[model samples]
Target: MAQHGWVTQTQNPARTADAWWRDAVIYQIYPRSFADADGDGVGDLPGITSRLRHVADLGVDAVWLSPFYTSPMADAGYDVADYRDVDPLFGTLADADALIAEAGRLGLRVIVDLVPNHTSDEHVWFREALAAGPGSPERARYLFRDGRGPDGSEPPNNWRSVFGGPGWTRVTEPDGRPGQWYLHLFDVKQPDLDWTNPQVRAEFLDVLRFWLDRGVAGFRVDVAHGLVKAEGLPDWAGEHGLLDGTVAPMWDQDGVHEIYRTWRQVLDEYPGERVLVAESWAPTPERLADYVRPDEMHTAFNFDFLETHWIAADLRESITRSLAATAAVGAPTTWVLSNHDVVRHPTRLALPQVGRRPNGIKATDPQPDEALGLRRGRAATLLMLALPGSAYLYQGEELGLPEHTTLPDEARQDPTFFRHNGEVAGRDGCRVPLPWAADEPAMGFNKTGATWLPQPESYRRYAVDRQRGVPGSTLEMYRAALRLRKELRLGRGDLSWVDDASDETVSFVTETPGGSVAVVTNLGREPVKAPAGEVLLSSGELEDGQVPTDVTVWVRQ
Candidate 1:
């Protein structure tokens, strides 16, 4: 593959004068669950455009739409079948164009998901690869290798899927014999594309240009760290999980950076501050920083911060390290609390912090305390907003929604569930449809059809209609905080720790052009005296002059 030099000096004409993404609050919309128009039971592009008003009113700068590309819905939309067109289930290319125009009209930039690391087994290229048999150019576009056994029956290596089971699946060759195995770090339906192939590189670059020309503000690069594997399809010696940060041959290879450098050039061609946000899971903050260097990507998700336990000391340390790491590369860090993949942070924070970070907990597992979880979630949001740089808000999280932990087994849709044979419940709980109305059928998510995933009766209480403008509602808190975040210019500021805070609380000050804002969060059991400053906002009711446990307060100093 030809390597492109980093073009650091060229400025993109499409870049917004403000470079909106640099401290922007971007909302991640899981289209399938966000809103469904046309009574289709599934959310679509028009549905998202219809709800842009709500997002605009929330004061976010951009909206990152998860994959709506043509797919078999295997691994949901992550198993992309066609990068150039919208899935009928989503809508048409015209619908996406209308969406981009409508969002721009409403002052919200649009960023679409790009799954470059893999493609659906049903994708035209993958299907052709299978039909072309081993050693074909089509097969070379993906990771297909001869098995290690005498009859080539065994897999090439011992790698396992992040969803469980073997990562490689043997395919019957066109000649009718058991043949070369293909790699799928996730589901068997999603075969990892071989970045080593020039065709694959040219295809994605053109794909980026297609959307960029259609006026997408940017792309959220999925599995950005795993696009390039080590040479010779080496065997595994490290942990098999995707985001664990273990040193693995299949992840965060140096070659991936070269790919991003090429991608950066593609992004620089357009204006409007065209950006590339990475969903990378490199081992350390320092390693993660490499993805966002000036010549590489624009930003990478701070999973280190997201996966950290709900401990004040731990969170402070992670936040500190994240800021330092991004600073080293001159890039802003992006923070996210909950997304479609993980359990709602509200519920996750409420649970007892024990063992490895739990992605989701089944109803049979120890349940989180609702009150405690909501309280902590609100506090955490405030703490995140007070930091310097970008923040990605998952849909429905602003409503203080907790995970629907009791979904019936038959209703589960995540591939992880089926792959694990129901032992592990998977991520379907967090991807449930958003509630829009307290009294409307399907919570106003669908026109007259059932939601793709059942919404709990509990969701009615948290519906948008019920919470809108209600004083102290989670929705209202988020609205006010976002408005204040901009007025105080916190996003494009520098963060520094407040040295006098106790270990059980995390305190920091963001020095921005507007002013210095102090944020103090109490994660302990007792109230702590409010730091000396003018109190601006509190995630919960303050007790006298002190901040209560599981609460965060902002002050102007």
Candidate 2:
């Protein structure tokens, strides 16, 4: 076995089949909020290494680590300054290597987040591009434009960045001359790279090779659809001048397929089984499937389930559309109910009676016991895993941890919230530290001190240490669901919709090569009659196999 970036060779070639991510459950770990090894109040690689056993105990096949590469922390590590080294704040390259090794030892494949769409303003490539002249080769590596607006006042095009404000940022030359402008879809400090540039494409391929050679099983490509843009820099139409004074058309750009095709070629060079899961926010299933074509990504996280309203019809329609879209492309699909960037489903879908208000407002009513929210979370989890696709579980989701947004204004560390005038509260609520114990402060996530983000107070009832062995706990439910999924061979199977007498219930049947399983879920709050079958698993407070209302049931027909 050779140690390089994050990969090591296996002694037995036969172990390749055990790579396991094809139908495997993946747990997403946001490093900055996972655990603190040296008590720096921030999660580091060594801290994650120490926590690998906890993840493994959840019965997941892999751990998807969010970005921990050398960065300015502007976007909490999405802005990479150095691709090859681990940030000093999160330990060194040696620490990453150790984490990878420990994960592999625990039989958990490690997948890392790859942000190729852009880089930090302080990155060496951006620095070199700035040093190069207007027509220099280095300058061609990024999207650089000349001049001000047509009226000599604003950006060249009526394009508003995703983070609010104009997408263009003015850059000055060393001679104090206003040189040109660059495009940043999110923040001015994070400049978008020119994927059309051959050199730029080749350089990123090298970065991928650097990690693959070391032993990383795969990547979760961030903003996978934003890699390409409309060529020739055309101006968008309309008085987009009203809101941030601009609007940019962003959808289904040409030449993106070419870039992905090239990436596929590079990934094929590795001998072991590796996967590439893309994060594409395209609303339409047809467009989202484009990222997972045979030669592109292995799977694209289908986020429609995350954004859809908590209703039977909508959830059923989204699932059917996702299955059909991926099946059409002969590409596998992946499902995610929650991630670092979204509101936790447990907190998001809890009924109004549970003190969760609609429209993102805090409820003034008394909060229900945490068990009620946990029940809803478990139901959603079952729904996600039962679907015919790979599934992703956010770090604290296994414990049914809800979101935490009680941080004081001074402690709000997310740059998006601050930079965007709080138009978006940002993703800090879902990125809180993992709670390892109920008795300890900070929930044992940090032994030396507090964490970068505040730990959720509700963790006292949902910590891993307290729930791992408890019957009917969220952790146990997740383990049971995953084990049942494997025993029934749900992932590598064909799905058929079951027509229920009631519209409030969504039921589907899965037929695998080994056997078949039927899953029925009642997405409504009202009591729904159970469809007749051999019930296997339920998300209700059942004793002696009697299911309660508002339950999810898996049965064998």
Candidate 3:
């Protein structure tokens, strides 16, 4: 690590005036859980448009909508059947057009999710492939191969699904007898596309142009790194330790870079500084940086920091490594804590800090320490906002919501839950609908008193109306921090270590055009002396002029 972080007097060329995504705060909206405008027990495009004011008021630069493409809903909307059209369940193509127009009116750009890795089993291409029988051109578009055993009874390889079953799903041939098996890294409904095929590449390039012409700024690429697999689909003998720095044949292949470079060329053709954000889970920061090289993606999520424990040494190391690595490639780092696919950070951080990260909590599992988690969560958010790069905020995180650990097992809808025989709860907990007001039907999410997933009783306390104007509330704190983050240009600033920080705290000073801003977070159990400066904002109240445990403070130098 550089002695004072990745400090540079030179500005990255990608930070040109219109390249907003480089230092922007993009909010991720899981369409199914954001707001139900139609009162049909599910969120839709109109619902999201209705809620755009709240998102804009939060000072976000853009909104990344999760997949709303026509789907069978087997893996939610991720199993996209049609990339060019909106799902009827999520409204229609007209509704999506209206959504983009309204968002632009509110000064927010839109980035839709693009699932290039796979298509729903019901997609026209897949259906045609099924009808074409073995060795047909349609079958060549996907990873279709003959089964290994007699009568094709076995899967071709030993690859297991990330959702907890065989990666290969056998399909009957056109002649009615059992035939070949196709690969699906996720659910059976989502068959992985063969990116090696030229037609597949051309289709995705067209998909990119289709949305760009409709006014979307860019895409939050779903399974960005998994699109290209290593040659010959090799078998893996090692455990898939997601964060253990293992490189699977199916992820982060070198061929992925060329694909992005092509997509980047399409983005440059547009008027606005279009962007591409990769959700790559590369084994190292250096490898993750490859996706965002000058001619590739604009940014990739920093999972190294997201998976770090709440220890100061580990966090500092992660941050240091991340900034150093990304800066080397002239790409701004993108930070995130909570998302639709994982346990909420507040709950995750409150648990025992020394173990494998929980996939999702269940009623039988040890629950989170709510108060402890919120404090730590708040501190972490403030720390993240003070960093010099772009950030992504998952919906409902601003309200400090935790995982619904007690969600009834019978109501779980994540395919992982079913695939795992209900042993793993999956991600339904964090993806629950947001609560906007107390005393309103479904907490202001809908009028029919229904939600796709049940919200907890505590949701009323975390409702947006309950915290909107209340001082020190999580919502207000976030608003204030965002306002200051932009006013002070913290996102475009340079970060340096605070030499006097103790071992239990991570402290840094950000230098911007206006002046210097100091940020300190006390991860220890006891309060510690804060860096000397005028207190600008804090994640919590100061205790005797000291930063308390699980708290962060921002000060002006």
Point to the candidate with the largest lDDT.
Answer: 3
Q: After superposition, how far is residue 176 of candidate 1 from its true place, in Å?
A: 1.2
> Against the unseen true structure, what C-alpha lDDT does each candidate score?
0.87, 0.75, 0.89
Q: What is the alpha-carbon lDDT for the whole of candidate 3?
A: 0.89
Model 3 stretches with alpha carbons more than 4 Å out? 1-18
What is the per-residue lDDT of model 1 for residues 72-146, given as tens digits with 9 covering 90 to 100? 998889999899999999899999999999999999999999999999999999999999998899899999999
Q: All candidates' TM-scores?
A: 0.96, 0.90, 0.97
Clashing residue pairs, backbone N/CA/C < 3 A, model 3 = none
In model 1, the worst 10-residue window by lDDT is 1-10
Minimum summed lDDT over a 10-residue window in model 2 is located at 1-10
Best by TM-score: 3
TM-score of 3: 0.97
Q: Write the per-residue lDDT of candidate 3 for residues 94-198, one digit (tens) a residue.
A: 999999999999999999999999999999999999999988889999999888877778888888898998899999887898889999999999999999899
- lDDT at 46, model 1: 90
Task: Identify the superior model by TM-score, candidate 1 or candidate 2.
Answer: 1
